[model samples]
Target: MADAWLVVIDHQRIFADPASEWCAPRFAETAPVVARLATHFDDRVLLTRWLPGTNRNGSWRAYFDKWPFADRPDEDPFFDLVPTARDLTDRPTVDVTTFGKWGPELAAVTGQYPHLVLAGVATDCCVISTALAAADAGCTVTVISDACAGSSDENHAAALQVMGLYAPQITVLDSATVLA
Candidate 1:
């Protein structure tokens, strides 16, 4: 798809908050790359914020329970998007309540777009999850390597390999490769 939509995941206040359960210092590192891409392709960009919620008594709760700090109201902030990413969302930003964005929340927000160029924080989690989902939905998915930050470098590399092997539908490329 020549006309691809850029998708940015998470990069929210909760994740960006140094006090949050899954905060990553490297999230700030991708700011420049994300800003450049958004500037170049403003109309096509779609940013997503993770709306934190309770898993309740479900199986998912078990995982979240282990990290109860994330569920605290204080951990979820009003301005969750990184300042850099927040500026980019002036074009369009979707509030996704779930980990995987394949549901109606994103469908109602995204309207129609064939290509999904994904970037943002926690590559092994939200970024990886959304990439596979978007690719399965028939969109051409490409993960902007440099514009994405994982909780750790090893996790980021592992996520890339996992996505490459399992989600062959996705194309893994660095930000410069696509932005240039």
Candidate 2:
């Protein structure tokens, strides 16, 4: 597993804090599972944060318009990593404007074709976005279901099912299965 990098995605205040409209209901419960999964990655971990692009070009402009609260600058407290997850910062970290974290910024950190173990919040969104893009880019991807949270339980399962369709390129499993 040394070659595989554990990428913890968007475990931010906006998605984890109950007061936020974008909060993921299971985010609190998923944090511990993510922490435990990080231990298995050795020192190979990449923590990713989502921030609104300053430009907000193309469809992104409309995307942000629909969710105005998240349109703030990256430094906003709304984008901070969940308190309990800050301890996992011993490894490398990156801030991304895009929903998918598998572009040049990530490729530079994980290498050209990396094997990624993904865990984090909003399975129906960021987790799914990262998984497909990484897999499509020829990086082997594994998403830990229990270590991720979504807007709703149904969305989480639906996202998992969608990602599972990618099969050999992208595999979805629970934390226990991976830990075992």
Candidate 3:
């Protein structure tokens, strides 16, 4: 896998706020190809950031209180981070909160990259919940499907058909086969 680890889910600012309601013009058309794969894999990118508050209660405050302009502030203005991406100097932006970004700061930030090349936005919630929680933490995943973006298009084709029929740990490549 070439020391994998390029996550970028939840490309924030309320999912690129086009006035929310989970707007998705293919998430601004895959934000410039995920900002050119975070500038050609700058130390293998990682850029998650979805910090809506309200104590983030069960099921994330019942899934943002069913949107419709749900405003759970205290600081989460969509937790911005999509200004062309690539800012984490030596790759270090984690800031998690469930919805598939399963704990321990993404296992202490990719603990040494066994594989995880997922991409961004609401593909059935936090890019299918962090590619099925990094394939149940055994790692090795690759959901890139045009750099990802959902909340429509049939919830992004039913979250890539449940991460290809019930996530056998993931492998739904595209986006030029994980940026070649």
Candidate 4:
């Protein structure tokens, strides 16, 4: 697994909290799998948090306007990684303001790895976005299906199918297969 890296995307309190409007269903189940993956990867594991800024442009500005509740306070716990999913590794956590983690900040750290195993919340959103960007960046990407939670089951399945067709470099598999 020397060339492999596990990237855990947006498993934050905002998505894990059932009361939150942006909650991702089945986060309770997804958390354990993410934790296990972190344990398996140890130093090779990297976590990403979505940190939206006050300033926005284009559709993003409209998006924020539509869902003002999505604007979390700077110090809100909603932005933090889920309790059980935190502290699994000592690796630095990457924070991004977009749906994908393949931005300049993350690219600099992940470019060295040839393979990336991804897990986290909203499988149809951030998970898929990051997977595609990673593949485009020349990394062979594998998305841990069961370890990811989406807004709904249908969306999760559809996103995986969409990602399957997006590129040959992206593969969707269960965590057990990758961990084995």
Candidate 5:
């Protein structure tokens, strides 16, 4: 696990806070596990925030229209890393507007081909997106199942199953197994 880079994707207040309309039900429960991953991965961890994209062009225009609440300025506390996990890693937080954060920002952090151990919120959405893209880009990805929260339990399970189809490229495991 020494070379594994942990990417904590979109573990932000919007997904972790219970009062948010888009909150993931298990966000709080999963956060501690992610924090533990950060500690284990140390400086190799990259914590990400889903900031509303300024380029509201193309399909993204409709995306923002569907979730107007997220269109707030980047400074909004709603987009901040959840307080409990804020200091989990000292690496600069990667701010991405796209659901799949496997672009230049991430590649710059871990290089072109990295062993990415993924964790964080909306397992059905952001986590799944990042996993698939990174895997497609020739990086081996391991998703820490227990360390991710989704919009619902069913969705989380479904996403894990989908990712498992990628086999060797993307392997989903619990935190205990991953940390071991």
Candidate 6:
């Protein structure tokens, strides 16, 4: 098996539930792929949940204020990971308030690896943010294209293209290729 860490981002009910305002259309298709990737990575997987905190800085406070519905309580089902992709491994999950997972708290978890395979919801948002940060942290990042869903198909493809521009340090590939 490849000695790469798998980072699954924001595959929670708020983003995956079609009924929710934050739903990503491709989540249904991406969930199973993410699950399979998580299973393959096993102990090397790190699942990230975007949980907005009550306290925010500047623009983040305004951003959350504009979308008050997103201020979900900690126990709300909206914050939980989708059933199809939940708890597949014994590894601890990292929760961040921002779009990127490479925040101070996650540095220790991510710094241990030199290569990372990224997956999950909103390819244009959290997924891309995390991927770039991973590359900056000196990790070779490979994004599983089919395993990530964005707000729209166009945005998803655009983000992939942007990441591709990063070249050797960050590449876009499918789960089949990575798993193989």
lDDT of 1 by residue, 93-159 (tens): 6765567665555666565446678888789888888878877777667888898888889999999
Better of 3 and 6 by lDDT: 6
1-180: candidate 6 lDDT, tens digit per residue: 367788888889999888888899999999888888888887888888899876768898889889888987767878998887666666667887888886666667756446888898789999999889878878788999999998999999999999999989899999899778
Task: Give the whole-model CA lDDT for all candidates, comma-separated.
Answer: 0.74, 0.89, 0.72, 0.84, 0.89, 0.85
* lDDT of candidate model 6 versus the reference: 0.85
Candidate 6 at 117: error in angstroms?
0.5
> What tens digits encode model 3's per-residue C-alpha lDDT throughout 69-111?
6555635545667667646435656775556775578767677
Minimal lDDT window, size 10, model 5: 82-91
Better of 3 and 4 by TM-score: 4
After superposition, which runs of candidate 6 have C-alpha atoms over 4 Å from their true positions?
A: none
- In model 2, the worst 10-residue window by lDDT is 84-93
Instruction: Give candidate 1's TM-score.
Output: 0.87
RMSD of each: 2.4, 1.1, 15.2, 1.4, 1.0, 1.5
- Cα lDDT over the full model 4: 0.84
Clashes (backbone N, CA, C under 3 Å), per candidate, total 2, 0, 1, 0, 0, 0
The TM-score values for the models, in the order shown, are 0.87, 0.96, 0.30, 0.94, 0.96, 0.93
Model 6: worst 10 consecutive residues (lDDT sum): 105-114
What's the lDDT for candidate 3?
0.72
Give Cα distance to truth, residue 128, candidate 5, Å: 0.8
Off by over 4 Å in 4: none
Instruction: Encode model 5's per-residue lDDT on 71-129: one tens digit a residue.
Output: 89989999888888779877789988888888899999799999999998789999999
